[model samples]
Target: MFAALSEKHEHKKVLPDLEGAENGVVMRFAPNPSGPLHIGHARAAALNDAYIKQYGGRYILRIEDTDPKRVDPEAYEMVVEDLKWLSLAITDTVTQSDRLHLYYALCTQLIERNGAYVCTCDNEQFKVLKNKKIACPCRDQSLETNLVLWDKMLTHGFKEGEASVRIKTDLNNPDPAMRDFPAFRILDAPAHPKVIAHVYPLMNFSVVADDHLLGVTHVIRGKDHIANTRRQRYIYDHFGWKVPVYRHYGRMGIEGVVLSTSQMRLGINDGTYTGWDDIRLGTLRALARRGISPDAVKNAMLAIGIGDTDISFSWDNLYSENKKIVDPVANRYFFVPDPVTARIEGAQPHTAHAMLHPSDASRGTRTLEFTGTVLIPKNEVLPEVTMLRLKDLFNVKISWDNGMPTFTYAGDSLADARAAKAHIVQWLPAQATVPCTILTQEGEMSGACEPAVRSELGKVIQFERVGFVKIDGVGDDGVVAYFTHK
Candidate 1:
């Protein structure tokens, strides 16, 4: 519960001071440590970090663990780890859980100044005023009575559906949030562990006090939190504090589906994905499962700078960006799943060498130990044809006939293999293992998808004949379990 400290940086608008001169202003990524960080949080955290990096201001990582029901050491640690993995910089860290007393103290001070009061109400009581500008019965209590009541509530502690504290405001205002809103309430169901300990004015106590005390000169959060900003501004106004510059961008939405951190947490915990790293769900862990490099993630997300509008793009675009980052350095490797053992029927056990990368010979070469028999990994053989990498196999067309895997040496030549399309794939003998799992959609399974390795897991890899090879798991025989394009 140390008083909030601000990080300083130097920027002269046009020039940055080299010797630690007058670096002024500060910004932070404040996230609730209630659940795991999701795509929305990632975007907000990234933008805020990028802004601070650009302007040479301090980028602080503040944990708004005010919701005692969900706050925890684990959640705080996870947020820190997740943000770091996302390439967001944190010059400092703070947790709100450690500062509850400070907030309560501030609330008490407001009550003392006759700006707040205590009110006893139940569930039906708050709902009656939920959207209406109706005044609570205790709004007009004298300062003495307000103080006494507030003290009573403070000493009496909060219970489920019981008394609460209210900020005396314009009861007839059109904005329901503005009409004599409760500054604090009994939380029988607090977000964190200390639910019954202290009542809170969700936005007022959490947002306003934190921002001002932390010297957050600029707010780079998502638009979802924008409504709370108005209430926050009111608190600032009451304290006569200068408001910070606000940048509210719409939360990022992944292709075809809407994803919220709230939603992700439910899906992730309820077995909707393979943990959080299912690769297809738009979570950072999902990105990692796809073998995405941090640079690729930052590049793709950062491509769209901070904007008011939400970012929406196909899952493919993100993979495409990730491919750009991973393609160059990813060592060429070959994998065939659901192996339909392909016997070339007497093709000599020969060593075929191909460039690791045709365009860049410096990448070296790999020698495919082609024997008379090869495991075509049935997953790779699709009704459609795809090229099979022969270790260093340059674009090679694979054809399946009569359940055997074979290479077409003439129709497609070595010259053709250089093009990405050169890798043609089909059954070695025109028929392979009856279809297997394909791990696409990187999301974990709830009922069936859990550990269901389909083609989605290999979203970043392109299969020659099949769309993509979905690696399900490593097999006991040293073979990989795979499913064709899902």
Candidate 2:
């Protein structure tokens, strides 16, 4: 199930083509409205979007909210925002809660065809009979009786946990789970966010009904849903409907990050994480905060392809890809963390020009007026170092008088600094710097940065020796930025 990658597109790896591409292929990304999409969700979303784009078909974003217990009211819109942020071209949006009547009609049709039955058997007793390859007594009831029981379930004639609608598969099937599965059940406890109801269709049941009704042509999801696919196929076969093509990819593991929605919610409640957009969390909001572009994410997911082997997400690979996209455009500036004043003794006042970007001189440079005093990182002022180059500026010879830093003018030649084995470090003019705080995964690093960064609000820029960061805000209090990646 593989097709060569399109050379005309920006994608990096080959992806499989759909079986019926000329027939206006349709696909859907049906994520339960549990919470906002994390990095894991991006993989499936990206794959579906890529196929839709490649085939010139419709892409539907389906919000599966049938079970009231699992839905997050806020996530109804949060999921859409996440998809938009990722730049997915969704042709339509669907909410399963709004289509309950469709599921009911389909279930009734299945029962009339003897493909399903309204079962009131105790779950434990049914399991025993299913394990023994014996049909439950409810399975043999007349069609009229099943229809009456179905109506009873819908009209609240039967209480929750008293009756359910189950599909009829092979009783002698090796897997007991495949014997007979519940299609719809009664739940009266918690109310749904979008609609009020007692009879709720299970995921497998609603998914099948919607896929067929919505005319979905291809279903691509994680391999974990293999069992669900097998179960859904029974309904399609029973109704004599054409089944959509299926492609199941292996599980993607993102190491050193929390991808589970429940765990993220727990951490947010416990104050372990600042929010979903926290730099430490593996969410799209967090990635956006850190200046990770949607193109980088799409490219990264494409590189992983749809191989069956379980693969781990590589942060280094992602960072490398991001660096390629950001470096050419992100301007460079000097940021001194834990800044300390250095008094220049022999150096005269001079102006220094630092290129906004190393390789792109056409963007111009930032001028720094050095007036015999400069600010450098306190940690970089080692006791052993005798000489160092101030990045784009001249070299300085260091000395300590009464625990205070003093610098003497050294040769401005790069060759001279290299011969002396001096470390080239970033520095800012003491009078030309502004207060800046960089928010990182570890903690906040407060120091001084160039005032020129004020104009770069809401844009990504590099901090010379530190790393790339997105300027989130700038005001009288100074600049606040989120560290992207080195």
Leading candidate by lDDT: 2
Report each candidate's C-alpha RMSD, comma-separated, in the order given. Answer: 8.8, 3.6
For each candidate, give its TM-score against the true structure.
0.74, 0.95
TM-score of candidate 1 relative to the true fold = 0.74
For model 1, the stretches where C-alpha displacement exceeds 4 angstroms are: 1-24, 70-73, 121-134, 188-191, 194-196, 255-272, 337-349, 375-438, 442-475, 479-486
Pairs that clash in candidate 2: none
Each prediction's whole-model lDDT (CA): 0.56, 0.89
Clash numbers, per candidate: 58, 0
Angstrom error at residue 453, model 1 = 18
Residue 242 C-alpha lDDT in model 1: 82
For candidate 1, the per-residue lDDT at 187 reads 60
List, residue by residue over 1-486, the lDDT tens digit for candidate 1. Answer: 111211121111232222221355587888777655766666667666666676677777878766565565467677777887886668878766666667778877777777777777665776587557666667667878777776666675556557777666666656776655656665655455533465554556666777878877877777876766766766666667888877677666666432455666677789875565555465665555545556555655556656677667545655566555444434333334445565553344455554444455786755555544555555555657656543332234566677555754332244555454544332222121223344445432111111112323333333333333334443332223222222
Clash count (model 1, backbone only): 58
Model 2 segments more than 4 A misplaced: 1-11, 400-405
